[model samples]
Target: MKRTPLYDLHVELGGKLVDFAGWEMPVQYPLGIMGEHKQCREKAALFDVSHMGQVILRGENVGEKLEALCPQAFATLPKGKARYGFFTNEDGGIMDDLIVSNAGDHFFVVVNAALRHQDIPHMRAHLDEVEVTEIFDRALVAVQGPKAEDVVGALCPAARDLKFMETTVAPIDGVECRVSRLGYTGEDGYEISIPEDKAIEVTRALLAHEDCEPAGLGARDSLRLEAGLCLYGNDIDQSTSPIEANLAWAIQKRRKEEGGFPGAERIQRELAEGPARKLVGIKPDGRAPARQGVEVQNLQGHTIGQITSGGFGPTVGGPVAMGYVAAGHTEPGEQVNLIIRGKAQPARIVALPFVKQNYKR
Candidate 1:
């Protein structure tokens, strides 16, 4: 497995290492997953996410040329602003969800670590006119939570002025770094990209703050899940359309009218007619914790859907899950049963994002 530049630091911090998408990543620290999770919710937590893929697209009309690959209409996307989009196939299936930032001279894209091998090649094949370069000499880290702004601001005052989803090049510990007010944890935080050699130096600077603690993958997953964010392989895949995945919000209004991206026809049809199934939040009664692949059945005992991601939310103090169900059963307060351990457990459909997102807009 590939190891990130922070692997040795993770070991020194007594992180529990695990294999994640061909990378040796820290799943938890000595403080435990729940402890790290609560730390991010209540204070500030730092995460090493260097395993993710970073690609730079440079050329005239970079965003316009890249729009052919996804459903987002990047024509109106302002410079220094980032948009969340998917790399979809011809059939409207999601190849990978990515963040594309229009950074004046070039477009910066960040994709999931597991799908980098496929996503980079796919982008190159479709965006032949644009210069696509994979950046491997940089390390990415996230500082997230309510206190993150103050902590990060102390190091880089410029970051405090950045609006949500806005990005800029800022210096951290005297090392120029790309800083963005974006995160997956539904908090007001920043993702910083710096030279690999300066990763430790910058991380140490962030950790020096009394409010910041080192969080691992375990907390990251739980945080995103509680935020109602989809996990690429588990909640969404090549077989799932953006409509079914509740991602229509990412598609711009003009793009829906003048469709030019892959799967335009199918996606438009689904948008008009509605998808057969929809992803929704599920709250199981008690704390049994319905897990992924658990069959979801209606009150009448007929299977209606299955759980994609589920776990005990440390912040929520209860079991929270997100899954797909028949469109007819998607209303909040709708009752359903989850078959767990051979017993039918009562569950209810609820609005997404069990926790309120506190992004600094």
Candidate 2:
């Protein structure tokens, strides 16, 4: 197991440690999950996401190579912009969901911490003449919330002008970094990539702002869930297809018509005819939370699906969850039952993103 550069800082802050993807990480701090969650929603929170893998691909034909490897068309991406896409297997199942950014002469990628090892090899196998460099000694930190813009803007004024899904190279206190105006919290935020040696300095600088507090994985999980974002291993995995996960928008219209990339045929078919099961949001009637792996049943007590992600939504003031249900029963407001601890808890289908997204356009 590995620890990120900020492990000492997390320990100093009294963060409760836990094992995540073979890395020693802080799950929560003394403020607890609920407090950290609120701080992020109300102000700004800093997350040490150094365990994630950052890789750069460079070559004359790197765009074409990436287009072949990913479901999204990288050739159309403009410089200083980022696009979210999935790496799919031959059967149309997702290997991982990653962000691809156009960094002038090279492409920058941020991959999930758990899939870093597998993803690197998979990506390298498809490259013919591209330079793949793993930035192993770098760390990623995200400053997220409504006030994030102002805090980050104070350090790097150029980043304030960046729109959602945009990236720019900027210097913060003499530390060069690639700053992206993107986050999983559905808020106005920036993800900064800094050298491992400067991780503490960058974190300290961000935390100096009165609105910024150090957040942990517990808050991140809740925030992403409230935003209806999927976790790699739980909500989406190799067995789940993009269409089945209700992520059809990830496949651009141009790519759909041109038909390139692996599993294009299967994905196109699903787009045309729809998938057997679809991911949808569910709102539990009472405070009893619905948890993952719980069976989803219809009014007649017949199981229709299983909950993939669920928890008490602080913003919503109730329990909210997402799961894959048979397509026929996925309509919003449809009556459903969640079998929680052998008790059939009544629930209803609802629109996703229980909390409204506040992304700055």
Candidate 3:
């Protein structure tokens, strides 16, 4: 497995290592998953996300060329703002979900670690006469929590003024970096991109803050799950469409009306009518956590769907999950049974985002 630039720092901090998507990543610290989860919600947590990919696209009509490839309208995004959307195949299957930022001279995209290899070629093939540079030597880190702004502000004062989903070039201890006000935790956080050689210095500076503790992928997963955010392979994939995943909101209004993106016909039809199945949040009644691949069944023992992502939510103090079920069975308050440990555990459909997001607008 590959090691990130912060591998040594993780070992020094006593991070429990695990294999994640071909990378040797820290799964948790000595504080454990629960502790890390609580710390992130109450204070600030720094995450080494150097395994993710950073790609820069440049050349003439770059915005117009990329606008056709992504679902989000990139042409209208002002300088320094970031947008989240998917690169879809002609059939509407997701190639990858990415965060794109308008970096004045060019566009900067951050893609998932697992999809980096495939995403690079896929993006390049579709973009004509565009120069794509893969900055694999760069390292990325995330500082997330309610007090994230205050903690990061002390080190990089410019970050405090950035709105959610915005990016800016800032200096950290003489190292040039791109600080973006975005994170996976549904908190007011920032993802900092720094040169490979300067990563350790910047990470140490953030950790020096009293409010910041090192968090791992384990806590990050639970945080996003509680926030009702989709996990690429689990909640969404090539087999699933954005409409079926209940991500219609990610599709802008004008794009929906114009219907030009990939799989637009099917997506538009589903939007106008309704998908056969929809992703919904489920709250289990007991301590038993409904895990992925568990069958979601109706009261009459009929299998309606399957749990895509499920686990005990530390914030909610209960077991929560998100899955797709037949449309008629997706309404809030609908009762469903999740088969866990050979028993049919009682569960109910509830409003998404089990924990409300506290993003700084």
Off by over 4 Å in 3: none
Where model 2 places Cα greater than 4 Å from the true spot, the runs are none
List lDDT for all candidates, in order: 0.93, 0.90, 0.90
Q: What is the Cα root-mean-square deviation between model 3 and the actual structure? A: 1.0
Please estimate how well model 1 matches the true structure, expressed as its whole-model Cα lDDT: 0.93
Better of 1 and 3 by TM-score: 1
- Model 3, 318-353: lDDT tens digits are 899999999899989999999887789899999999
Runs off by more than 4 Å, candidate 1:
none
| Cand. 3 Cα-lDDT | 0.90
Clashes of 3: 0
User: Total clashing residue pairs per candidate?
Assistant: 0, 0, 0
Quote model 3's TM-score.
0.98
How would you encode candidate 2's per-residue C-alpha lDDT over 117-208 as one tens digit per residue?
89999888888888888898889999999989878888788889999999999987678889999999877899999988998988888889
